[model samples]
Target: MSKPLRALDEAALVLFSGGQDSATCLAWALARFGRVETLGFDYGQRHAVELDCRETLREGLRKQNPLWKERLGMDHTLALGALGDISETALTRNAEITMEKDGLPNTFVPGRNIIFLTFAAALAARRGIRHIVTGVCETDYSGYPDCRDDTIKAVQVALNLGMDSRYVLHTPLMWIDKAETWKLAEELGGPALVSLINQESHTCYLGDRGTMHPWGHGCGECPACALRRAGWEEYVAEKARA
Candidate 1:
């Protein structure tokens, strides 16, 4: 683990997706960074509901904590929905998700994190910021190659070199699983924030928020939902033991 950063009044940008992971990442960044901004993508995902959730959560957080709006800057939604016109992944397509070539799930959007981070870096540079936070976890990250630690590190190097800037890409959930993510939320704020995340964040591939599970509300069968549920169960059990 890296030493805890205490740079007062420094700014950071978080790639917020309005999911359980990204919401947790938003909280994580706000707790550490002096000023935090959020970036969201409208990359033609099947679950476009997440975008709405992103806004709702942002507003909810600001209302829940009055100083949050000042500490956490405005949220920006990028228009990369055109990526779906070029790709045939399950996340963008309405087809059933299956293993694609290279054993990755069809839901994996090719170069998603790559493109998101690149854009975020450019935005951060323009705003005189150096820290970019994302909520990509590899411990339970299904099979997305882009979510790996090495991939992020390589991208960080390439981004800094290409942009002639020093951008520190922070991945707070890189090594932790979903259960630990919940724990992180608790640590960042408290049970209220955790409850807020549970109610507002979107994580279902099928965009089914009607089904409520122990972890969150989603289509229980999807890979994302399964991982979330399992992680929640682990977290609950751990809490019980403690």
Candidate 2:
């Protein structure tokens, strides 16, 4: 990874959910910005255990590198039970996880990313953070519209205009597949980061942590588990080939 380029004043606040993608984005920010803070939302997600995963991941990250320890800053979590109250998707409820008739996965929560970003921006403004980092991706999954590059870009524009501040929203995994996401964690922080991600991060929609897979701990049945497992296999395969 390149040396930190941005100064402390140009710190970044990552929308961290303790999931694979969000954790990767946190690492990405820590490797570039001189200071990085994390923000998580508690929207009453079925996988709410992910909020607990944040602690171990952050401690693991701090131990991986002294630079990261120096750069990692505060962490925050907001109560967003209101989002769950209005949504009946698979993630917020015990409903069956499946593809809906609308061609999108039932896991899609309405205005999730948008609301997260807006809240992040508000928190950033209060904390004097100049940039926001997120893990929203469109490569491996296409079920969520808010994860699209255009949506992120549009949100960035609107946030800047509304807040009257130049807030840069960085999407490090925007174009990368899940496999490449694993590769990125490896590139940013080497084996320690990879190990931390595999063991500490939570991505299962059902919040399964009882069974451990090669990729990590998950139910190995949900769409999230399948994607992570496939990506880990591909990433390992390519490494073996190399």
Candidate 3:
């Protein structure tokens, strides 16, 4: 069994994407870590609008709490936009999202989590930060192999061996499904978190924020929307029963 969550009381760098999971992880880091920073990637996703949302949410979270302004340090949006030029995935291009023979979805960007975690580890090492937080959950992921716990552990070992430094990668949502994720958000920030997630965070693949679904706002057709909708329904039903 995986270990339970603990207050690490150390500086952390969160691999934030301005989505529900990342936002929740950021909130979790802020509550548990002594200091925190966020790193966002502009990998030229089809929904680059999420980048704008990241900045907006960062500011909004800061404004919501005085401690956030002081403890939430520099948030960086790195320019990996060149990934779009070289990669032709559904997330960065207009293409049909179908499953491959290998059982991975067309939306899966190969090595995305690996690249993100590598860069996060490097940045954290430079800043003397030991903990790197990410919201990669295998339980609710849409068949993204990179989001698996074993993949994360392999990358962690490779990073430590390559850099000769000890870095702890924190995956608070690894074992939890989406309903548990919603519960976690509420536990960390109460109803305000629910509002922020529903109103601000971007999870849609098509970049359609105008449409509303039971989960949140999205195109309502993508795999992401499907998982989110199911999770929200389950969470709400559980609450109603309680």
List lDDT for all candidates, in order: 0.87, 0.92, 0.86
Q: For each candidate, C-alpha RMSD in Å?
A: 1.4, 1.8, 1.8
Candidate 2 stretches with Cα past 4 Å from truth are 1-9
Q: Write the per-residue lDDT of candidate 1 for residues 26-53, one digit (tens) a residue.
A: 8877777778999999988999999889
The best candidate in terms of lDDT:
2
Superior candidate under TM-score, 1 versus 2: 2
**Candidate 3 clashes between residue pairs 3 or more apart in a chain or in different chains:** none
- lDDT, candidate 3, equals 0.86
lDDT of 2 at 10: 73
Q: List TM-score per model, in order.
A: 0.95, 0.96, 0.94
> 14-124 in candidate 2: lDDT tens per residue?
999999999999998888888899999999999999999999999999999999999999999999999999999999999999998999989999999999999999999
**Per-prediction count of colliding residue pairs?**
0, 0, 0
